[model samples]
Target: MRLQQVLSLVRKAADDYEMIQDNDKIAVGISGGKDSLTLLHALNGLRRFYPKHFELHAVTVDLGFENLNLEEIKALCESLDVEYSVIHTDIAKIVFEERKESNPCSLCAKMRKGALNDAIKQAGYNKVAYAHHKDDVVETMLLSLIFEGRLHTFNPVTHLDRTGLTVIRPLIYMNEADVIGFVNKHQIPVVKSPCPMDGHTKREYIKNLLKQLNYENPGVKERMFTAIQNGNMKGWPVL
Candidate 1:
């Protein structure tokens, strides 16, 4: 997708959800992936014309993996003139070496989020922007139903009372395909995930299932997304 299209969706989400306040400092959680990098660019461009002026801060929580380089991400941030911070952690060693749990995604996510939020809190950022797109929202709801016997997904705006940071997904209206197109069109450098369990998680399984279902029965995914929006799930805005 072009930058204009990306910005249009972003602006809609921010406006509808009241995500950006004047003088707000938002830390974009950069995972060195396409989704996060795309979010980084979209928010960076918003600084130019967004009515409610806000500053952008970019951060990556390094998992202490071997040969994990972030110089490209740093360069991209520099090109966009966004402030970047890299918080180095020993999560890799702890998860794979020490704990060695069969299901590492859950633990890894908790650890990563903890680290990311710590950085955001320390920097006095009141909000953090995640790159969860429409596909992720659907996939998560499916995961919740199939595993936990529940119908649920994250919302566009979530406030963490304890951390004093509100979570916002400005790309909530964006599809995963749009994100892939944006990254390819912009030549965004995405760092390959070096985790040993990259594609061996329940999420990966659900993602593949969604892709197959979409291929066989067109509009199934969209229908599911619509259901979630109207399902009256906690955290969703009244539609």
Candidate 2:
């Protein structure tokens, strides 16, 4: 996917969900992965012409891993002229060294989010942009149903009354394949995840399951996404 394609999808989702407001200072959560990097790039470009005139700040929570280098990401943010902030935390040591829990993804994710969100709030950003895509939405719903016994998924836009920080997922209409293509074609700088439990999680299981389901029944992913959009779920945009 090219810049034009990425912006097209992002703009559509933003418009559909009423995500960006005029003069909105949105923080982009950069995990240094393809998805988040793609979101940062898309939104950076979107601000150039989008009527809302939002500003972006890139934030990455440094998990205190040995080999997690964020210099390239910092340079990329500079190139985009987006203000960047890195919150240093001992999450890696806390999770793997101190706790050493067998199931650490949940705790690790929560800790990371807490650090990220706090830093975002400190930076005075009223909104945050996550990089969740179409596949993530469908897989999350599947995971909720199969594990938590609930049919649920994230919304394109969400408001946290407590923190006064609204969340927006502008890449909601994009597929992971398109993200990979965009990364490869544009040579986007992607930092590899240093977490030990990177690919061995319940969400990974759901993701693989969705792949098989798509293989057996072509277009199943689209169908599942449409179902979520039409499920009348609170926070979801009307179909």
- Per-residue lDDT tens digits for candidate 2, residues 130-228, read 999999999999999999999899889988887889999999999999999999999988999998889999999999999999999999999999888
Tens-digit per-residue lDDT, 1-239, candidate 1? 99999999999989987889999999999999999999999999988999999989999999999888999999999988999999999999999899997888899999999999988999899999999999999999999999999888999999998898999999988999999999999899999999988888899999999999999999999998888778888888756
lDDT score, residue 40, model 1?
Answer: 95
Q: Return the TM-score for each candidate structure.
A: 0.98, 0.98
Worst-scoring 10-residue span by lDDT in model 2:
230-239
Query: Candidate 1 has what TM-score?
Result: 0.98
lDDT of 2: 0.93
